[model samples]
Target chain A: MSSVLRFRDLTLGYDRHPAVHHLAGEIERGALLAVCGPNGAGKSTLLKGIAGVLRPIGGRIERMGCEPRQIAYLPQAADIDRSFPISVFDMVAMGHWRSMGLFGGLGQARKLKVFDAIAAVGLTGFEDRSIGTLSGGQMQRMLFARLLLQDAPVILLDEPFTAIDARTMADLVDIVKRWHGENRTVIAVLHDFEMVREHFPQTLLLAREKVAWGDTRETLSAENLLRARRIVEAFDREALECTRAA
Target chain B: MYDYLIAPFSEFEFMRRALVGSIALSLAGAPVGVFLMLRRMSLTGDAMAHAILPGAAIGYLLAGLSLGAMTAGGLIAGVLVALAAGAVARFTALREDASLAAFYLISLALGVTIVSLRGSNVDLLHLLFGSVLALDEATLLLLAVISTATLVIFAALYRPLVLETLDPGYLASVSGAGAPTQLVFLCLVVLNLVGGFHALGTLMAVGLMMLPAASARLWAEDVTAAIAIAMGMGVVASYAGLVLSYHAGVPSGPVIILVCGAFYILSLFFGRASGLIRLFSGRQHLEA
Candidate 1:
């Protein structure tokens, strides 16, 4: 497979304090990669850098052929406000934003696609329901429906299964697998090691720095996991900026 | 009853002017207020209302009750505070609410000091409590024009504004419209506030905007419905308040706000969205 994304000694963080440091790797096109690490391991931050939401503090992330809009980023559930006054259909329809744009009309074809996405996610009868009225599982389902509409080449999911019910999680996992089947590059930050192992073929383990990056079986061994835990725990809170050349 | 209600508006041109100006303000300000409440920036809206004061006060000092000067001044001050508060929240560790509160307090103090410096008590009352019943032709035209412009701008901005308010991070990822959308939305708020200040004084202008929007929120499930209901409620409150003020020999601005407050109270008890009645009945239904 061709390389879709190349991370060349990437360091990403807020206020010059690197959360993700000296990460160098290539994510192949259509790769199903799970980014698994303990808390504060900068999994989400790495996704942000790839999504082009945050500028890297050092090094660079090069998208081989994908345009900026070809990447769909799903932030953590906490980043979304469920109280806003919008219907489920309208929220899900936002996935078509890449094509519809700010002023583009949602023609009959696109509308049909939106309906299909909603129905696929088992939310057919909920098109008119206000988003605020949805349960947590239903909301996740609706967001996944939106992601379906996005249909981007590169998909970044940050803690997608957190706080969701098993049924919803199972449904969303299937969608991710389907994306992999469709030859889409998928990178997900996951806390559930079992889910990662079961679904993802490749893994990147990080602990404020890279621990391992390879096949899931080799990368997630007990020794590597323990080392990741130790490296994260022993990381200096007051470490000075790195002066090394990239 | 006709003589008391209908004749006052028919016989008095000032009453007619006041009614028209207020309805226009409601049409524009109510929708803007709905957005403010939806974004959970109702308090920021209030602060922005007060923040406009120093500029209007400066205008009042320079031009002596000129509508053109005061409107310009208020718009400039309101936008400045909005920008400054946004910057502080972005750059510093301080939260938006705290930064907004700090800026508005300073704005309010500065405004009161400016107003008190040269203007007479009567002039101060006029600035604090607007002279809605005495709106001249120019002020009436200004209100109508602003209302038209606001509605047109809102139509163009509707979809992007909704996305921006609902999921800013998602909007940022998809398109570059997020920051510009926020900037335009803030400009609309400032525009509506300036229009409202002319019809309902700085102190009570936010009431016509916020109270109706708050009441509408209890009644409507979606943003479009909330905005429509708020506008309708605002118009009703404006009409009722003006009639009552004419008959009762009371001030118009506070009367209009009081009428809006009555609607809010009614909605709090009886509205279907999240009213006390619905809450109680839902609980009872669960128990049953």
Candidate 2:
């Protein structure tokens, strides 16, 4: 079957260096594709390119049978602070940005969907609380609330489980599994091998270049992993330490 | 007690205008100021505050103290400078703060030079010190108009502005988000700076924006609540500043800034978020 998202010889980068080059991959419908590599392997950049936050420099990125607005993207929550002055309701309500029309206000039905999404993430009674007051896990749950509202068939996440609670991580994986069961394509940029082994069967191995793409066990070989580790652009001792501890 | 309450209300028109004008600006500036603090754009506010000096000089040259001419001239110059800064940031290698500081500082230096060359006998105190007792009807009306328009627009565009401020990639439109929208917004920043330059003057006009908002942040967990608290602090301080200036016979501008300073200082000790009071109180109180 034709995949949901197809990247054909995709080349992308900042001005000087090549971050992701000569990447060719297809994400099958209902498959959980975990992109694994070391730090600075351009996993985040690739997700950003696919999410429309960044544009590709070469080749093709096709969203077949999909519109740009329908593709749900969970960007790295780097700029967002836990101390920001916002409510969980306001945060999840952002998912309805497109449906709100030009004025950016949600309809009554969409509003209900927001509540449903929050409940799905098991964060009931959190709608009115300040986002700043939440733990990292709760914050991730709130983001999932927004994601549920999008209800897109294709979901792209850039390191969603970083610095969050174990329970939230399990919930997130289960939610991803649920999405796959529903025939939705899920592409996630992940650093943790254990997470991929337990949750995702399909894997896409990348390190600024496409190393390998196949079944999780096949692509996550020691040799391929060593190559990915060697080629990864940044030295994330912190992430490695966390992985070891986990 | 009677004097404290009734004197301000029954005072001279300039006092009434000063009281009203400062309150309007404090309310308008407080909300925007809170966002600026969140985005770390308070430095931009400082830069822009100083940057408007040349525009004020230009205004002085054209109107010789005509509020309309001065406001128009100052706003025109402010918009142009902000537009230039925006364009430079988009097109050049220079970062936002570096470019803004350079442009604003250079303009301020140019202002001093021009004022020295063209102005009569060059009394810098009027520009720096401020005289709230000199506000006329026209200036008061202008303050009212700016206040109303600003508050209304802020209410309408609050969410998008917050989102855009937090993350540019996710939601920002590619089409520059238009000049008029930006022009009006930046002009508000500029108008508050330039308009208050006479009554409260340049430095404090900028300083008070950050101080009250920053203090309010310590007390509030939500943007709306923070904004409300900030406005309350700003208004009360504005009145206190004017009264203090009246009693002490010191300059109004610095006194007003000093009042905001009080709030920030007090906030450091008593604020809900990072307060010394909370730190001590929590330790003393038993917990599970």
All candidates: TM-score: 0.96, 0.84
User: DockQ of each candidate's interface versus the true one?
Assistant: 0.71, 0.25
TM-score of predicted chain A against the true chain A, for each candidate: 0.97, 0.88
Give the chain B TM-score achieved by candidate 1: 0.96
lDDT of 2 by residue, B62-165 (tens): 66766766677667767777778888988999888888988988887886776666565534556555566677787778777777877888887676666666
TM-score of chain A of 2: 0.88
**The candidate that achieves the highest TM-score relative to the unseen native structure:** 1
Specify the CAPRI tier of model 2. Answer: acceptable
**Candidate 2 regions with alpha-carbon error over 4 angstroms:** A38-40, A101-112, A125-129, A163-165, A221-246, B1-4, B80-104, B121-123, B167-187, B247-250, B282-288
User: Where does the lowest 10-residue lDDT sum fall in candidate 2 chain B?
Assistant: B172-181
Q: Mind sharing the TM-score for model 2?
A: 0.84
